[model samples]
Target: MSTELTSREVCQHLRDAALGVRPLQVIGTGTGQVSVDIEGWRLQLEFDGKHLHHCGHCCCPDGREWALDSRQRFGTDPVSLLSTWELAQIEGLLRRAE
Candidate 1:
């Protein structure tokens, strides 16, 4: 029998994979907020479904505000461009949740 994976496990796996890559960026929507989890870095944004308000937490290193500009173009969509392994792990977590 195959063991089911939990969301925490999935997240941890993703985190580990992110560590392998030079830079990582994650975008997801929260309950009433939107968050960006780049590797282990985190940034939160509040939106009223029209305008967005940043929470002053940006993952880009100092003297690199341009990076934020680059990230902005990516838009918001969790798991939009995940790898096959990542998608499988997340699907496993979702299945376990059901």
Candidate 2:
């Protein structure tokens, strides 16, 4: 079996981590790319030496998925695949991505 996280799984993982249900570990930092990991999958979340950006989907009104790229834009449909309130929920959950 495979332990690797699918894109959807990674999205959900980020959601969970944002909500505090899962742990989001900051493994490395380079101002431009802050390395973070959940379970096993790792991605460099964009950091401007202090805070993280792109906290949600790109299309939503309040979505901020422009900050980070797992490999490409909209890599996770977190806000894109959700309803109005759900979109807001994710936006809030990942705002303080630590």
lDDT (CA) per prediction:
0.40, 0.48
lDDT of 2 by residue, 1-98 (tens): 54333446545656666566777666766646566665654555545644344333222122222323467566353334444454454445434554
Q: After superposition, how far is residue 66 of candidate 1 from its true place, in Å?
A: 15
List ranges where model 1 is wrong by over 4 Å. 1-26, 37-42, 61-98
Using all chains and alpha carbons, the TM-scores for the candidates as numbered come to: 0.26, 0.47
- Each candidate: RMSD: 13.5, 9.3
Point to the candidate with the largest TM-score: 2
Q: Give candidate 2 regions above 4 Å deviation.
A: 1-6, 49-51, 54-98
Tens-digit per-residue lDDT, 1-98, candidate 1: 42432223333434454444433333666654555554444545444344333233334333222122334433223233455565454334333322
Total clashes in model 2, counting residue pairs 3 or more apart in sequence or in different chains = 1
| Clashes, model 1 | 0
